[model samples]
Target: MTTDHLLYLCFWCFRSIFSVITFSFTSSVFAQQFDQQYLIWKQQQNAHDLRLESTLTHQSAEAVISKKLEPKQALATTGLSTASERVNINQANVQQLQKLKGVGEKKALAIIEYRQQYGSFKHIEQLKQVKGIGESIFLKNQTQLAL
Candidate 1:
């Protein structure tokens, strides 16, 4: 090769090698910084999570205490009737059926229509056979249901 070409080639090789070494050094420094920052973030996250758990536990305990203090009032507000006041699904009207948990107007009407079409319900469990009434609805209203 010509002298000028040889000089240019050597300069390019030196610049490339210098760039690689600089990049590697910077990468290691950046990786260390990133790892340290990540550890600090994890520690802060753990502390915040602990604080949230404490707050949630305190709130739940207060809720349980309040419910225990006024169980009958809570039951009345939740539309759960006592055993003596249980709704007879075979005889209850749409409004009476609606008083059961998870039973809206549609569900109540569905129950009445089912009862009329099938005659009196032989057992409380038969309520699950109606359309829109599944296991969850039947279980929720089981205590309030009768023949």
Candidate 2:
């Protein structure tokens, strides 16, 4: 072949090889970028899942603590008495004294009013000042009642 033709062939082959190398390098770089992005996304998702799990655990712990606290609060408020136990007219408030078997709202209010005017009861007999309570009711509840 002519020298000019041979030179032209060599030039074309060199151009093709350069183009292939450039394309391979570009493809490798793009693939590496995609892999890095995928890894970052996976890490973010894992972190989000961990946060959600921790929040749920905290909520459950709060619920359990609330459940445990409720009975203690009830015991404190009710003075360790069951519903059947007679309430102390002297020490009890209007709301607490009203929970007694025979006591109603009016009686409860009357007891508070009498206590406020006359001060603390010295004996169970002082409860007779309340409207509904008489000798018989006081006698009946005397064993269960307190000062």
Candidate 3:
């Protein structure tokens, strides 16, 4: 072959190789993005399934509770009691404390601990001294408190 033809052939070969490399790199990047998107979609689907499962479990528990108790008794015993029922802090037990708004098991236990550590509650305001019982919580249950 002539020198000119040889140069042209080499140039074409280099261009072809460069094009192949660029195309391969672009394809790899796109494949990575697709993989990431598929993973995210799968994770979201799993979360949705978990939420549905939780709803079903809660419904099952509620069905059992409804069968067990009269509606009024069920409400109170389930810690969904009305705020109308008065609870004397001095006289109330762990179960009674749990019935109050925002008073979960931990808070109920804290109240019992405080009552046991200190003497009986002299004033309704003393409830504010308990851990987790801030001003708002104390105020909310103030109406339902007695000596």
User: What are the RMSDs of all candidates, in order?
Assistant: 10.4, 23.2, 9.0
Off by over 4 Å in 3: 1-75
Cα lDDT of all candidates, in order?
0.83, 0.76, 0.83
State the lDDT of candidate 2 residue by residue for 77-122, as single tens digits: 4344453466677788877776655677787888888888999988
TM-score of every candidate: 0.46, 0.44, 0.48
* Residue-by-residue lDDT tens digits, candidate 1, 1-147: 999999999999999999999999999999999999999999999999999877765655565577774554444454445655688899998878888888899999999999889899998988999999999988877777878
Model 3 is weakest, by summed lDDT over 10 consecutive residues, at 72-81
**Tens digits of lDDT, candidate 3, 1-147:** 999999999999999999999999999999999999999999999999999877765655675576775555545554555656788888788888877788888988898889999989989999999999999989888898887
Specify the poorest-scoring 10-residue window by lDDT in model 2. 71-80
